[model samples]
Every structure is written in C-alpha cells, then in structure tokens.
Target: MQDKPENLSREYILPDGRSVTVGDQLFRAPEALFAPREVEAQGPGVVGMVLRSLARCSSRIQLDILRNVVLSGGSTLFQGFKERLLKDLQAAIPSIAPVKIFSPENRILTAFRNMWITREDYYEVGEHKVKDI
Candidate 1:
C-alpha cells in the first residue's frame, strides 16, 4: 500500500468517534478582533486601534510610522494576521506611500530586543541620568 497522506485539515474526528470539525471556530475569535460586531463586546478592533493611534500622532511622521510598522506579541503569530492588518491599513490610509509590516520569527523576544544597549554604543551612566559619551 502507498504511504498514508498526512491529515492537513484543521478538523478531525474525536477519539470517541465523533466528528469534530473546525467550521467557524478558526475565524471566530480573530474575526472579533478585526470586526467586533457583537454589541456586548463593543470595542475597537486591531485595525481600529492602530488607526486611532496614527490619528493621534502628528501628520509629519504618520507615513514613517506606517511604512515601518512592526507587530510583535503572541496574537500576531496567528495565521494571516499581519496580512489582514496590512490590507486593512492600506485601505484605511490610501495616501500613505507604502505600508510595511514586520512580524519577527521570535516574537516573544521582540520587546526585549530593543531594551538593551550594545557595548559598541558609547554611554556614560551617571546618578539618575544617562548620557551619550
């Protein structure tokens, strides 16, 4: 017999022999994050939040912010999250020259990566202050 093909679908039968399928489960939670239509969960979605943030910033740096967008965090690891966000953002701000989104492979360390100072950078650490040497 030929080798068995791998089960590629997100659904499967339970050990009890009941058919357990993904159905709408895959998109349910994430859909709420992008388009929260339920009145009980009324709040801004991810795209809405990002747009709001950009709106608060001065117009001068908006393009820069949009062009160099970096998305870190566990939620961003979800499939197609970045692509969806990019599409939404591009639609929302068509005037921006370009919208770039970066999601690092090691998302858990993304936040900490920028918190350290490299030895190559000159720095004088004084009491209650830090200054470049």
Candidate 2:
C-alpha cells in the first residue's frame, strides 16, 4: 500500500480558492476488508467471512477451497488486496494448508456471465433441461 505513486492523489477545491489534497483515499475503502474495526462498523471483516464460509463446507474440501480461493468484485482490484487477504486467511485458517487467492481478469463480467449462463452451457436434470428451470 505504501508503494503507491506520489502523484496519485485526490484533490478538492474549496470556494475560497483553497485546495484540499487527499492522499491514500484509494487505499481506504479496501482497508475496511481487512480492518473493519478501524473503519468502525458492524459485521465481520473479509477474513471472518471467508472463515465462516469455510466452516460451513465439508472438512475434506476446506483445504481445497482455501488453496483455490477466487475473489470477485471491483474492490479486489486494490493494490496488495489479494496478498493481504491470503496472509490473513492463512493465519486464521487451521491446519497448514496453502492459501491462494485469484482475481479474474474481469471479475464483474465473469460474475455477470455466470449469473446469465446460456441454456446449452448447463446439464439436464431427470425430466427437465436447464432452460426449463
């Protein structure tokens, strides 16, 4: 996060010809994912969410899921977000399973396509096809 370029700053101008320089604003939103307490709000952070999800899955698949974690959404694009998430998850998850986090080249598009899959892309059930559902 500290490696951000110097010129990467957000600025606001006041009515009296004064300017307000905003630094690190880009890093703030994603910070909530890791340190929700610092942001001061309800609910668990991203690591907590992942742990909760892992807890619900079968023990056999838990390690596999951790090893192949895929993060979706625009917030995942933040610098070092994936690495930080992996580090936190690794520390929190029990066992010595390796943790890997992957963000798709275009996560939003991938999510949209997954939600809107074509009929031919899905398998058929006992008496009905995917399109029938």
Q: Which candidate is the best by lDDT?
A: 2
lDDT of 2 by residue, 16-93 (tens): 999998777767777888888878977789999999999999999988898899988877888898889988887886
Query: On a 0 to 100 scale, what is the lDDT of residue 58 in model 1?
Result: 96
Question: lDDT tens digits, residues 40-120, model 1?
Answer: 487889999998999999999988999889988877877789999998888988754699998878986777665655554
lDDT of each: 0.76, 0.79
Worst-scoring 10-residue span by lDDT in model 2: 123-132
Query: Which 10-residue span in candidate 1 carries the lowest summed lDDT?
Result: 124-133
Candidate 2 accuracy as TM-score: 0.69
Show pairs that collide, candidate 1. Answer: none
User: Alpha-carbon error at 113 in model 1, in Å?
Assistant: 6.0
